[model samples]
Target: MTFAISKTASQIAPFRVMKILAQAKALQAQGRDIIHMEIGEPDFASPSCVHQAAQNAAEQGLTHYTATLGLPALREKLAQFYDGFYHAKVNAEQLVITPGSSSALQLVLTAILNPGEQVLMADPTYPCNRQFVHLLHGEVYSVPVTADSQYQLTLDHLKQHWNPQIKAVMVASPANPTGTLIEQAELLKMAQFLAQRDTYFIVDEIYQGLVYERPAESILAHQNLPQNVVVINSFSKFFGMTGWRLGWCVVPEHLIDVLDRLGQNLYLSAPTLSQYGALAVLESDALTELEQRRQIFQQRRNRLYAAMQSAGFTLKTLPQGAFYLYWDVSEYTQDSERFCAALLQQTGVAITPGTDFGKEAGKSHVRLAYTNDRIEEAVQRIQGFVEQYR
Candidate 1:
């Protein structure tokens, strides 16, 4: 007998970036030269030290499974990395190393939220984040974040959106798509608002160490560990280890036991090799390599911003961190999917459509990811496409 998909699955939409990326790949497989800029992954290699660690671990035959939560050593090292970067009082017991930050978030949502419970986030944030929430049978609510809000969460927005049904607030500093960090004052305000309501406050800091605008403005810098905050981080972005799929979540001590149980039942264990690679990336000279990558992306952002502005697209918000420029394409076309698709076919430049982020997203906006292998070439191509559109 044939089975039907769950009603919940219907609510979850496909990530538009993945679809565009697939189309670009299919065209390239037929030998078309498409300037790649749709995906946000770093166009760099993991440092040699990371690879060497993986090699050493493999040589020592250390691939057997460990604690489902994570290896104690990796968890401790991750805490050390956090303590060094965030200067927060963190212990290994407050952390869980999942396969990726994505899974870590899923575990948190699953552990804390019941069916129909709502989690609040800024609209036009990350696509997969909403999907993950839906997969956990939780409702993901979007609070409209505008350029006025710096595309980050604001306390006013929270007050308007908050309710008893709301179980958590998912805030991403250096958020995906927008690449904007929440200002310090706004963060403190948000922390206070959520703290009073006794709702969960989750911070996605995967892009923490890569920040260019400010160095150490973590939410962890402002709160006690018991204040209902779970900090999510990753080896991707800053460390250039997307494929390694290693990321961690710092949970409150109360949730630690439940997460450990869920981690055991759900994930079994994170990859041993990736853990080894992450350990080296976190505690070695690999920081130098990561810093060099930041310089390259920072330069690319400057170039892309100038080029996009010259091409008639208005920079709605000059991104302070991350590698994207969220530009308003209203004058060019209201339909971002069609606009981006036409640009690719016409100029061989593939860019992500803004609609991937939220419902309000598909209209008159485009997210151009400038950190690619042919970053210079991509900008030149984007300049040509923008000129033609103008």
Candidate 2:
């Protein structure tokens, strides 16, 4: 007898990048040379300091459960991080550590949304966000964003799309796929508007430290942060700690207890060893090492950007942060998924189809991650593939 699947489980779309990655691995196992440009994980290992810290924790028998809200010292360090990095004043009391930014997002959405309440976010966003909302039986209202706005949501977009059903507005800086940022003035305007409507503003800052052109700032930089604002961040990206499965979120003071209780039940606590490692990375030496890696990523971005443009790919916006280039592949194929699969099979170059992100403009686009060190080789392969179509 077949078991029935829940609607949430059935309707949640698969993250297509992982599928492509699996296929890419299959080819690699068969001795095919694959140039990976699909996954967003940084190629670098976690800082030496973090490694040392984790070892120390393990040796000291610090593997026991931490407070559900996380180690007080780690939370306090993150608060100081905001002050030193963004000149933003954050209270340690407002922070909650979780297994990953994914968990942080889950807690925030669960705390604020009732079933059927809506979340407004840009289309072509990180694919999992809509799934997160769907998991809670909430609705996602996607606003189609384009290159004209640098693929970011503007205050005007929010004003036009606002509806009574929308309980929250979520956006990411150095956003996934596109690697673009929301303009600061526009972000501020949108935040104030949401505050007036008693709606929550959720900012995803997982890629905060990898910015290229400008210094990254937290929304808390505002002298008076709105009570409804929530900021989610992680050690996964810039800190090169993806495997550590650690992240944190800063919420309004009023929601601290709600998140603490929710975290206690849902996660019990983030990984204790990972928490200790995170503490080491927050120090000045580790930060300096991360900065050097940022420069390397910037260099990779520059090299790949020019090569892709030279290969006749249409890149509408130069990525400001993160390590992705969402380029239009419509000139070659209208079906990005098919294009990606064929490209992988034929050229052994793996990249993600835009369909993984959203419906609008997805078929015409593809996202290439520059996270791997083989970018130059990948572009050489991509150039040859494009030339065949041309």
Candidate 3:
């Protein structure tokens, strides 16, 4: 039987990363022996304490449904996290936990945008942000970012694209794929400017704790009261719990009730076990485990930086935050997707094409995920691939 689908759903294509990943996986299944860098996932498993917490939760029959707003304990702990990291206090009443940050984004877009409204974001950033806009029947106004600006969004660019139909501005710090962050000064300027109008401001902080050189700042640190920022965070990155489908958002007090209703209808509540596990992340000794991993990622980031530079590709920016390297391959090849695919086939190396992030700058770029838990082997394989290309 032919199944029915929404008109909006029919118009959009599948997430490009997953499509490429599926092709790469299929090739590997044929004994291709691909060295995976195409997908963005942590190499480490969830920290042992987190796993133990999940076990305890399941054994306690915490499997029963929780408040749509999230378990009270988890919410309180996340509030403390805001105060600690961002140096800003958030009430638990402002929080709503959802299946994943991805789903949280959908509700934020749906809650605010009228059909045909515009949602603004940087083009050379996350692909899924654009997809979320489309899924909500909204248009995207891409703010073009350049390597000179560290590929981060600026307040000036915000003004260039802002319009009457635009309802919100979506930005990610330590942004996905690019791994670039919006500077705190620029972030404040953008927040203050948006406050001049009725526009909503949403900040995605999924990569908050992954920074290497400098700590990634949160919008909560600087935004004014009545909390104009709808801040999002996830357990997937820092907790090494990507498979857990857990995330939280802090809305304006007025927005929380609406978000809770949406959470109940859409998610029911983030997986019960993951919620209990993330409680440990927010409230317990999880920070020590996270810090240990951070040191390792910092070293891998340095290793990948040197390797890419010596390999003859340009070092546009050596990612100040997040675990990615978005650099130019234009001097070597124009078709990044084909270059990546051929490299994966020939050298057993898989890196994501720039186009997977955005169509404008993507033609000449590729993103290298330095997610090597056993990084030496990944680095050596990359070094070998570079020599062969010579």
Candidate 4:
């Protein structure tokens, strides 16, 4: 019996890292000591306070559905967080909490895009960014960016690619695969450019709190930001709440009703217990714990940067934030997916092939997520694997 699938489902690309991770898991089951560096989840657990909050909520039987937009208290807490942290005047009415940043992105895209319209994005970004557009029957126009631009889209790139068909421009800062950020000034410039044209601007700030050298600011914090702009953020990264599956989006006030309806239909609400736990995550103690964990991630980034360099791989751009190091492995192999497969099979170590991020220029690269506790051991195994190829 043949089952018919929608064209959207058929066109979506697979996340190649999961395939590598599955193979690594199979090897581990066979008594192999596989050191994982493929996935982008933190090794740390959620803060104790968060866990306790969830437990307490469960004990009180607060496990039912929340308001479609979110619990009023959670939305208020998030609004306060943005105002206190960044001085961004965010009102609770503009916030819509979702199961994760992924869904927040989906809501924004679905709310703004009409079928066959184009959305501009940087190439070599999070693969799902484009796929989400495809799921809505929207076209993705990828502007190829390089290390010089920190793998971020530039004003000139936008000017070159901007067309009448384009409806939105989406970007991720402290971007995935590269972990580089768009400078605040450049972001403001892009915001102004889009504002003048009345084009929609979407900024993914999921890695905001994890920045190392400089702080990553949200576009919503930009004064006089375009009314069409939307900001996507999550509790999964710095807050160490990956399994909680909680995140929120800041959209124009006018879209709140539309988004509320979409949220009602799509998820009804975010997880009730997670919302309660996230309230504790905003407490002073949780912030301190998260900052300490961030320092550890920075240490891992420094160690991995050094290790990959010593192993004859050059990073195109040094990672300034997030827990990933994207490497240029052209000298060792042009086919990164093949290189990753051989490395994992030979050394029991896993890294994400750059091909998982993008096709152009991505084939010569790979992404190593420093989310493991055994970074030194993974480094050693990686070095040994590189020696065989050299």
Candidate 5:
């Protein structure tokens, strides 16, 4: 007998970058020299303080399952972090620790969305957001945002796309691929508008600490935030703790009990050792080191932006935050998927095709992460590839 897979499983698109990464790894196994710019993981290890804390936790046998909500101390530390960093008064009760921002997002959507409900977001987003919506049997309404609006959904855009079906509006600040941020005033206006309509507003602040030229602001910074407003953040990007897989979300007080119940069933709790380790991440010395690393990332962004332009790649927006450069490769190829695959095979440089984000405007684009130490080498390889292919 034959069995049928779930429709949701069928609708999920494969992460094309991972496929390129696999090929790159295969080439590397064959002794090929590959410069990776495809994946968005930071190359740095967790700070020494965090590593020490993890070691101590292990020695002390703090490996047992923490409370479903989280270790009380870690939750309190995160709550205080918001007050100190963003000037937002987030009580410990408002925070939920999840395995990662990915899982946090899933739990948030699961807690809020019913079947056939919809969430509106910009096209060419982080890719997983739409997939999570699909997994929950909800619809994703992707608004096509351009560089003019900094690839962000404006209040006017939200108004234009407003319908009873749109249950929530999700956006990433210093957004993935584009690395553009929504101004605080615009965010406030959106909050007010959504509040008036009783619609949910979810901001993905995964890259908050990675912003440049402007201070990182949290949606929680707004004292009058709508009851439905939620913020998701992770240690993966800024703290260089990707493998630790720990992240937290700030939810409305009313949904705390619901999420508590959901968290109980999720993974029991985020990794206990990681939580203990993350406690040291917010220390003054660790933050100073992290700030220095941020400067390095900013420099890499500058170097790549200039190099990509010199290589004849069209860049519409300069990245202000995060460590990604999204380029319009229309001059080279209309099919970004083919362009990426061929570039990897020929030059041994792996990059992400924009098609992985969305098919609309993403067809003529590619996203390169500046997370590697060999930015100059990657630049040279890309320039040579463009000279040959274009």
Candidate 6:
């Protein structure tokens, strides 16, 4: 007898970057020296303070499940963090802790969308976002974004795409793949527009602390954060706590109870020890250490950006934040998936294909993450690979 699979499960595409990573590991097991440039994970370890905190929690036997909404103390600390870091007035009552930002996205989408409603986002977005919408049986309306707009959605895009079926708009700042940011003024305007239409506005700020050009700001930085706005962030990228799987979000007060109930039903609670570690990292010295790591990432970004351009790659935009550089490889190959596969197989350099991000312009593009410490050597390998085609 054959088991039936739901169409939603069947239609969901695999995250191609992880597939590349798995293949790279397989090669590594055979003694191949792989230089990873594919995944968007920080190379730095979590701060000593965070480790100490987690150890203390374990020693004290604080392993039981916290509240479904997470530890009240952690929530309160995050509120203080927003107040001090972004000067954004966030009440502790408005925040909810989740296993990761991915779970936060799932919660927010589940709460807002009815079956068949739509979410409007840029075409080349974080691939999992579209999948999250699909998991909820919601539709996605992707607006094609080009380098002309810095690979971000503008108010005009929203205005043109708005339909009665569109229930929310989701976007990321210091966006994945491109590492571009939506201008603050434009973000505000879009938020106001969505608020007027009674549509939810979800902003992904998981890469907020990795910005290079200027101090990072949040949507909550606006004097009065529009009630329609929901901000999602993670400790994974900024604090080097990816393995801990801790993240939080700030939502409107009215949705707090809804999220709390959902949280109770979903996973019950986030990891208790991880929450304790997160609480420790919110302190001043830990933040300063993370800031120094950000500087190191900026240095790597600068080196890789110049080297790739010197290698005759077309980098349309100078990534302002995040560790990714999405470059056009159309000059040599239109098939980014094949290009990435060949690059990994031939040179032991792993990078993500544009197809993993979206269909529009994906075949012509590829995303290289600067998270690996051996980036200089990776650059040399990539340069040699490009020369073979040239």
The number of the candidate with the highest lDDT is 6
Q: Provide the TM-score for each candidate, comma-separated.
A: 0.95, 0.98, 0.94, 0.97, 0.97, 0.98
Please estimate how well model 6 matches the true structure, expressed as its whole-model Cα lDDT. Answer: 0.92
**Could you give candidate 6's per-residue lDDT for residues 1-390 as a string of tens digits?**
989999889989999999999999999999999999998899888898989999999999999999989899999999999989888889999999999998999999999999899999898999999999999899999999999999999999988889889999999999998999988889999999999999999999999989997998898989876899999999999889999999988999999999999999999999999999999999648888888999999999999988877766678999999999998888878999999999999999999999989899899899999989887789889888877667
Error of 3 at 172 (Å): 0.6
Report, for all candidates in order, the number of backbone clashes: 0, 0, 0, 0, 0, 0
Which parts of model 1 have CA positions greater than 4 angstroms off? 223-226, 386-390
Of the candidates numbered 5 and 6, which has the greater TM-score value?
6
Candidate 4 on 1-390: residue-level lDDT in tens?
989898779988999999999999999999998999998989898899988999999999999999999989999999999987767889998999999999999998999899999999887889999899999999988887888888889998888888889899998888998889988789888878887887888988899889997654777777777787789999998798999999999998888998999999999999999999998888546787888898999888988888767756666778999999887788778899999999999998899998888888788888889999787788788778777667
lDDT of 4 at 78: 93
- Candidates in order: C-alpha RMSD to true structure: 1.7, 1.1, 2.1, 1.3, 1.3, 1.0
lDDT: which is higher, 3 or 5?
5
**Candidate 4 lDDT for residue 380:** 82
- lDDT by residue (38-122, candidate 2, tens digit) is 9889988999888899999999999999999999999999999899998999999888999999999999999999999999999
TM-score of 2: 0.98
Q: Specify the poorest-scoring 10-residue window by lDDT in model 6.
A: 306-315
Worst 10 contiguous positions by lDDT, candidate 2: 381-390
Candidate 3: residue 267 Cα off by (Å): 2.0
Q: Estimate every model's Cα lDDT from 0 to 1.
A: 0.82, 0.91, 0.80, 0.88, 0.88, 0.92
Q: Give the range where candidate 4 is weakest over 10 consecutive residues by summed lDDT.
A: 307-316
How much is 26 displaced in model 5, in angstroms?
Answer: 0.8
- Tens-digit lDDT string for candidate 1 (1-390): 979888888787888888888888888998999878898888888888999999999999989887888888888887787678777767788888898898898889888998898999888888888888888778888887788977888888888889998999998888888888888677777877887888898989888777775675567766543367888888887888899888889888889999888989987888889998888887897887787788888888888777766655568788888888787778778899998888878777888888988677557777888767576677677667766566
